[model samples]
Target: LSTTTDNGTTALHFASVGDASVVLSYLTELSTLKEINQQNYYGETPLHWASFTSLAHVKILLKNGADPTIKDSKNNTPLHLAAQAGNSDVVRFLLEQKLVDANAENSCGDTALRVACEEKEL
Candidate 1:
């Protein structure tokens, strides 16, 4: 159930990037919620991609137990990616999660707020 592509991207990642809500639901049903947080070669979880792709995808992943605090290879959480990508809704949603660390920094020592500021998303 943890099958992935060459880069370690699982079906959930594809579904999230494509915003295929039905496919996502089906995949979730076929697999366990733990699969929802599968990471790619770069350590980017489905949530990381979803944060910049679709809000619905993010919501589905979160509801299925995806950890918002999970970091990628660069040490950037889903919230950091969302902020860096200027996804205000994703950022806001992530901030609402109790596990989300708003002050969490990436490998570069940049927080979500700093990323948002650097990206001129403020």
Candidate 2:
């Protein structure tokens, strides 16, 4: 949990992107919110990566202290990325988490609802 790549990408981030929920859960168990929510060069957290990977992964990360409301460098929340990825289940799950700000806008002033509509999932 103390290791990172040049971009500050931790094992949790990689595992989230790879949809390795088991590994993510294990790593998250050994991590604090600061470590599990560590952002990469792009300011994306494991939850951000998992938002487009797997709902199961998102759930694990969320249950393990990953913050659902963190914004990336672009100010896009996990909800935005999930919507952009057309992961309806993930988008729904994220919204249900309630910690996420559905009204939150990105750098382009686009809300998660707008992003979902753009992805044709709304």
Candidate 3:
């Protein structure tokens, strides 16, 4: 009953990016591989989408065993994405993990906090 593309972009990804409620039936109240937050063609994990979009999936995915410190091919972590997106909620949640590098910079020498500040000022 799943309809994902070649790269394995599942319903979870859409739910994380759009209507989270759209996946509650499949994500919540269950513990299956459906909860597996894998990467896409862009090397972006489910946490990346969740964070990048500033969706509540931050805590949801973490609670479901998502790694907060996982990075993408561009050396950008979930915290980095969230920061760039200016989602204060996701940033605070990631900070609470105590595992993220507050000064962790990307290949472009941009840290999560730095990107957050820069994007906000823009």
Candidate 4:
């Protein structure tokens, strides 16, 4: 149970941040995988958090049928967050799924690829 009452965080949020296998498995049994993609107070989905951290949860959630193209309140998708975090693993993973909108811009009008270029020396 979350100590914060208003955050309304789902098991997916924590799972995406890192290795939350135990909780994730439990939640999977209780709820549908699509429910894991639901948002929290910050309007971030599980895929968003997972990609941001370059965690295996990204793959886990993906395999469980999570949508990679969903966006947050800032109009940033999981791919955008992954690029900003410079997580090559997550970026590659997202690319392989072919769900990312390469031309998709954030609230700032920058694409995820653009954000990646800004963060990486390449």
lDDT of 2 at 57: 92
TM-score of each: 0.91, 0.93, 0.79, 0.83
Most accurate candidate by lDDT = 2
Write the candidate numbers in order of decreasing lDDT: 2, 1, 4, 3
**Local accuracy by lDDT, each model:** 0.85, 0.87, 0.72, 0.75
lDDT of 4 by residue, 1-122 (tens): 23233686765577567556666656545657557667777778778888877556777777777788788889999988888988888888777768787789999999988998988822
Per-residue lDDT of candidate 3, residues 1-122 (tens digit): 25567886766667677665537445634535445556677777777888876556766777777776667888899888888877777788778768588888888899887887888821
lDDT of 1 by residue, 31-115 (tens): 6767877888999988899898688888888778888888999999988988989999888877776559899989999999999
Q: What is the lDDT of residue 22 in candidate 3?
A: 39
Error of model 1, residue 81, in angstroms: 0.5
Candidate 1, poorest ten consecutive residues by summed lDDT? 25-34
| Superior by lDDT: candidate 1 or candidate 4 | 1
Residue pairs clashing, model 3:
none
Q: Model 3, stretches more than 4 Å misplaced?
A: 1-3, 22-25, 28-35
Better of 1 and 3 by lDDT: 1
